[model samples]
Target chain A: MTLKANEIKVGDTYSEEVCRNLSRTQIVQYAGASGDYNPVHTDQLYTSEIAGYPSVFAHGMLSMGMTGKMLTNYVGHGRLTSFGVRFTSQVFPGATLTATATVTGLREEGGENFVDLDVSTTDEDGTEVVKGTASARIDA
Target chain B: MAVDRFPIEAGHVMMFARSIGDADEIYYNEDYARSTEIGNIPAPPTFVQAGAQFDPDYFLRPRIGQEWFGSAKGPTGITQRSGSGGGSGGGGGGGGLHAEQHYVYHKQLKVGDVLSATTKPGKSWEKQGRRGGKLMFSESVTEYRDQAGELVVTATSVGVRTERPATSS
Candidate 1:
């Protein structure tokens, strides 16, 4: 869907919170697909014994990807101009995540419309995992 | 650093989508994707984070003596900090933490695309932390291009290495 710049309202949010549940297998698949084999994400024993975490945890990129899915679904693919995130907390197995994107800025630059989004993801307890912002150009 | 060219396959795209709990059919089924505006399976937005996996000489590979900040066991061996820590928090012989990530898309990445990437350290700075002492920050930018030499995606990630306070042993 193409977002019309004129139709966007600053401070107006789009969509409800999207949620997902974390699993170990998914983490391992991500490790394989992403080529990030750091044991903290795949090996429970290594995480607990070597890394000192209670269990293998999700990669920060995994959570960031989830947020990307949310924003892309809202704005459409290949239309994104910029996306970014700051990793805030560790996500462990079995953690449930919720994410949302809000329209923070809308304007016309060089005759093209753009929308600024404030994106955030939190666990079930409302603790922030990833906090970020994305800005995209709206196709005419 | 240079990331060797690698083909973007449909299966890997699908796997990455599922791994993130995204069940979108366009990322997997070519037939379904063909019906979409993209006309084929295009990777999810952050899919390029896996760009390192495309290269054999990715600098962040974990080794015995290489450490920047947090746990060496994390993907890319970059650490994640929880805001409260002594020197013990980000140890691993000086490993850096993954501070931030930014991506700018010029073109969509689709299946069957052979892509190569080049990464270089960008800006570097330092700032004091409340409890973690002085933090040294650096940015790395990776540009991905298709075989035809078109820019597909440009991803920039920041890392922070901590220096313990004088009080810490």
Candidate 2:
């Protein structure tokens, strides 16, 4: 039930169109589930006044989650072996977030099929919130 | 969460790794981790959150006793290979939409390295979402300090939440 390496070639793109919008309750829940509760995430006044933000924002991990969705949707679950990323900018709430993955490398090593992906989450203004790479070992 | 009272210890690093489903050798085996560039087991960026350490009352007083849910909380690998929790479509965001996410690693986390983390709400607001749904993003900034109280890592996560659409399921 997993995607094989040969099944995913370079230049493959998955449909990552956002389906539904995220809400406040979900943010609170994520904080609870993830055990993160920085004021910058939940307080608009602090962000706009103290932190110098236009408003509150989404968690960088959430942006990464979107990238994970893109990779999993394309390569399937078990097939994805490693995923990592670096955060570049803040993602404000209500900003349209889009996830995309570009296969940078597809090779065989130690008798394994692997795909190297350059993933990213961008705002409607093309602000890259999270940039990352994901590699998957396709089923033989 | 009794985070500050947990009494951070070197032994707890391994225990934290086990709790988060990360079996990365570097996190569990000090010797193996020492062989890497980090010279020790590097804490997964998001795994740092597991420390549950908070700032002293005199340091960040306004942030004491904040309420936290266990829903959208995700780990951002802080200073090394980082990330955790998987699933597609934010079918479970508590109230905010996931606008963006990113992590910056200043160095590597090693075995026996004791660290502390404190959480605080960033900001909140209302915005119009596509199709008229209410949208918001909640940012949480956690500061990680080493045993010497030196700032080791600073992690900020944003939770973008919007009202679920009223369209057909």
Candidate 3:
């Protein structure tokens, strides 16, 4: 359902535990679906010996995809007008993540209501992994 | 990356939604989707990134009869190594890493919509890094258009090439 403009305030916030103990299998699933089979995300041997990382890590887009679920759940299906984010930290396997969206502003344009939001996703340690802003259509 | 024919299929949407842990009925249930405001199963906000699947020259996917970069019988499949760093769309062969992604949706992308994408380089810059050495960042803008040639989504992707493999702090 769409958000009612009268029911939401500028400071309203929504959060979700996007993932817990992220798995290498899930990362592979994302790689298959997104068609980004970067060995750094799936091949532990290569990631450690060649890439020089402790282990394979999640694709930044996968984290963003999980975070987008929080936004679409908050704003309603197919209501987003814009969404953006920066990959602040790398997310590795077994990491747990939570995504939050905070309402920052509301406006009316061309007889339509819209909401602006500040979005952030953090790991178990509260390390911000992704941060950005989004805008979505709302019910007037 | 450029794709001449990227069909938004239901099976692909379901798999993508599931991969992201999204259980929304609208993403997979056709009957439920028909009753929604979008009137059909719509792609998730970040779904268009899958356009790489349709890009024949996408380097991330290992080509048949070609040497891959990931581990196989040994630590790596490729024999010779390049000194170049990694960036966006680069995985095993010392390519770049994805730094940032932004999207502006002109309309809801739904199942059955055929999309074509065209990408152009935007800008590039460099900066010294504390851990990964010099960081080279580049931007690319891609436009997705529907069968009618209507722009459906405009995406800007930034990729960073680190002088060395990034370490967790």
Candidate 4:
């Protein structure tokens, strides 16, 4: 169901626990699905010894993908007009993430109602991992 | 990356949605999607990134019969280093890292829509890092058009090449 423009005001927020204790297997699953099998995300020995990271980490896109779920669940199916994000920090295995979308503005254009959102996803330590904005169609 | 034929299939959509931890019925169940406002299984917002699967030359994926960079018997398979690992994370050898991604949806991307993508370089800039040395960032925009040649999605991606590996702080 689409969000009703009259029901939401600027500053309204929705949040979801996107993932908990992120696992290497889930990171590999994302790599397989997204076709970005970078060894830094899946190979432990390669990541530590070669890449010089403590361990395998999640793709920035994987964090963005999980955050998008919170947007679709808030806005409705097939309603997003635009979505963008910047990767702020690396997300490693065992980190829990929470995504939140805050309503920034609401307007009507060409007879279609729309809602603009400020999106942010943070790890268990409250460090922002992905940050950006999204706009979606809404019901008046 | 350019893809001549990127079919938005149901199984692929389901796998992508599941991988992202989304349980939305519209992403998987055909009958449920048929009743929704979208009227069909629609690709998740970030789904088009999967077009790399159709890109034959995507560097992140290990090509058959080629020496891969990841470890096999030792710390790495390749004997010679091409460049330094850079980017935010998930660096493929010395390739750039993904910094930002943006998408504008022209229409709902649904199952059965075969998309062709064409990418164009956007912009490039440099920045100084506190610990990772110099950061070189570049942008690329890809337009995904359906079989009928209608633009379905416009994706803009930014990649950063750090002078050295970015250590997690």
Identify the candidate with maximal DockQ.
3
Chain B alone: TM-score in each candidate? 0.76, 0.54, 0.91, 0.91
Candidate 1: segments with Cα more than 4 A from true spot: A15-19, B59-94, B163-169
* Candidate 2 structure, TM-score to reference: 0.48
Q: What Cα-based lDDT does every candidate model obtain?
A: 0.75, 0.53, 0.92, 0.91
Residue B94 CA displacement from its true place in model 1, Å: 9.9
**Candidate 3 DockQ vs. native:** 0.66
DockQ ranking, best first: 3, 4, 1, 2
lDDT (tens digit, per residue) of candidate 4 on B1-169: 8899999999999999989999988887999999988888999999999999999999888899988888899977887656653223435474767899999999989999999999999999999988758899999999999999999999999999876678667
What would the C-alpha RMSD of candidate 2 be, to one decimal place?
A: 13.9
A best-first ranking of the candidates according to their lDDT comes to: 3, 4, 1, 2
* Per-residue alpha-carbon lDDT of candidate 4 for residues A61-138, written as tens digits (9 for 90 to 100): 999999999999999878999999999999999999999999999999999999999999999999999999999999
Tens-place lDDT per residue, model 3, B140-162, is 99999999999999999999987
**Model 4 regions lying over 4 Å from their true place:** B79-94
Error of 4 at A130 (Å): 0.4
TM-score of each: 0.83, 0.48, 0.96, 0.96
Q: Quality of candidate 1's docking, in CAPRI categories?
A: acceptable
Docking class of 3: medium
Give per-residue CA lDDT, model 1, range B98-146, as digits (tens).
Answer: 7789998888888988888988889999998768578888999999999
Question: Cα deviation of B108 in candidate 1 (Å)?
Answer: 1.6
- Candidate 1 per-residue lDDT, tens place, A50-78, comes to 44456667778888988888888888876
TM-score of 1: 0.83
Candidate 3 lDDT (Cα, whole model)?
0.92
Q: Tens-digit lDDT track for model 2 on B1-169?
A: 1245323344555554443333456556767756654565554444454444342432112343543222123321112322542211122222333454344334344445566667677876677865777767677766666666766656666666545521211
